[model samples]
Target: MASPTPYRDENRRRLRSALVAAARDLTVAHGWPGVTMAAVAKLAGVSRQTVYNEFTDKAGLAEALARHEIEHFVDAVSTRLHEHGGDARAAAHAAVLHTLAEAARNPLIKAVLTSARGGADELLPYLTTRSELVLAAASAAIHDWAAARLTDPDPDRLALAAESVVRLTVSHIVQPSAPAERTATALAEVFTRLLG
Candidate 1:
């Protein structure tokens, strides 16, 4: 069946965004385990039933939050990649530099990495070992972009390179280091060469 009016869709999006925003804030301040549907409902000014109606359950909300975070990073990475024009090296360098900085400070990421500090951080696994959502999304996006930019298309090679970039970069996010800039620069060099 056809959808409803644009207004309805917009309202739906607005409510969903608000709920996610509320959940994120609560999670960051109180930890994932500390957050509940009731708290999200109160913060978002919606009823508890409304939160469940939109998210199904706590796990669903966490998954949505993870997807939102990954998508944001994917968009930023795409923009950074394109900003370098046609220079693969320059694009990779810029993308790497931008990505590492975001990863370090991103609250969603902090929520996961700082699990010991607070909360069960159930969402962390969805980003890391439990699911391949981040890796798959990132690799596919990078592969598509790199394929279009390449003079000679090589599917296997391009896939491997993109996967490497996503996996290695995400690994650093999971464990981190004293300085991410150095890692970003080195990885950018490798990815640049792979694409070049």
Candidate 2:
């Protein structure tokens, strides 16, 4: 058989994105337990078989949703970093503040972080226990940003700093103590000290 054309690939990507968006909406509205393959199919204007074909199973769909959201968060953080224009402390502050504020307001994130109906949330593991994607993507973004923007950076130190900041940010996102601005300020100080 011939390989798939660019057009076919683009169409598949669009369909997959639509399905993921539908799942996200359902999850935000009704939590993970309320989301069903049929519901996702209905929301996306596709058939149940199409949803199954696209995702293979519920676990696959959950993974896709988590990856998409993590990428989105990382992209936003990267943008904030770039906006600060080489001021590592400022970038860290802005990125962490934005992430914390956004997470607080995001219904999907709230669903993932909180219990669904006073029971364990199946999707929570995607953000917590099985969060390699989150850590890797966020750390890579910070590492790349620091390497480009900071002068004469030590690669090993830079990598460690990036991973440290990402882990701290994730922990804050999971269980915030103070206000976003306060937590962001403290984290920025930590990041600056780590960079030194």
Candidate 3:
């Protein structure tokens, strides 16, 4: 077996990061319809060939960008959870509230919502497909947190619980009638009851 080459891995990471950054910037600045392979490559400071080498087409680039965004969002939530410390339930609530608050203010998410409502087919793929991916990532994070804190580690139950938490959080983001902190507190109360 050959050893993994660090240099090649680094280059791949850099290229992928560049591509994702370019796609996001282009989509934000020019809207989803205006983002093209050529434009993304140009913004990324790489050749069109390089862009193709990394992503098959604009859709592929969008998927990659979506995954990157989801991962970043998850990382941010995880950081909030850690910052809360000790109280798992409170941490989970704080994480959800903080995440939704940030998402409410995020320009990229706003663009996606607008593009989807505007009936732009190009943007729809990113909105629908990437949404599922984000949901899955969120569920996984919640499942891990639950397993660590709860007495039972039933995978199926954990999955369901995680999905519920994500669904509720998403609902708050979609229609925030109350303050984010209050919404998060409500979610945490529900989650704690579920565990109990």
Candidate 4:
């Protein structure tokens, strides 16, 4: 079998990106229920068939959008971790602060939270209930940071720290009881204990 041509791969990537972008914008504007495959195709300036070709189905499309956004968040977290170099506490503090602040500002996250105010909740499962992807991705990012700074970091300890940090920060994003700085500081203290 022949390998996919470079032009074919590029076109596929571009089309998938366009579809995901369109779906994300529509989802932000009007809950997931409001976004239809037809609407996504129209917004993407592509045929419905093309959208299906790229994503297979609605579930696939939703997965793609979630992955895109989650990875974007991971990138931000990675950057914040790197900003603190070898200071595990500072890295934890910075990453938590940055992530929570961004979650408050991100349109898709806002959309999901806001949709709870009305009748149906169509878009939150990907983030809240069915959140394995989000948790796993976040845990991986946190583990990477911890592993880089901790002395021969134990896998179990790294996993524990990662899950603790992600779950704590996600709780804050879902419902902020205190300011992020305080939360970050507190979380950093925990990290210092775990990694110290």
The lDDT of each candidate is: 0.80, 0.88, 0.75, 0.84
lDDT score for residue 148 of model 2: 81
Residue 94 Cα positional deviation in candidate 1, in Å, after optimal superposition: 1.8
Instruction: Enumerate residue pairs that collide in model 4.
Output: none
Question: lDDT: which is higher, 2 or 3?
Answer: 2
Clashes of each: 0, 0, 0, 0
lDDT score of residue 116 within candidate 4: 59
Q: Which tens-of-lDDT digit does each residue in 69-154 have in candidate 3?
A: 77888887777766655465787788888888887887777777677667775654543433678688887777666556556666
What's each prediction's TM-score?
A: 0.89, 0.95, 0.84, 0.91
Q: Kindly give the stretch of ten consecutive residues in candidate 3 with the minimal lDDT sum.
A: 121-130
**Over the stretch 1-196, how does candidate 1's per-residue lDDT look in tens digits?**
9879999999999999999999899888877887899999999999999999999999889988888888898888888877776666777767777888898888867876686345475887866676588887777667656766657757776777777777778777777664777887888778876655
Which residues of candidate 3, in runs, are more than 4 Å off? 1-4, 85-88, 121-130, 153-156, 175-177
Best by lDDT: 2
Ranking by lDDT: 2, 4, 1, 3
**Candidate number that wins on TM-score, 2 or 4:** 2
Give the winner by lDDT: 1 or 2: 2
lDDT of 2 by residue, 37-153 (tens): 999999999999999999999999999999999999999999999999889999999999999999999999988766543585788776667778988998888887887898988
Please list the residue runs of candidate 2 whose C-alpha ends up more than 4 Å from where it truly belongs after superposition.
none
Model 2 residue 124 CA deviation in Å: 1.4
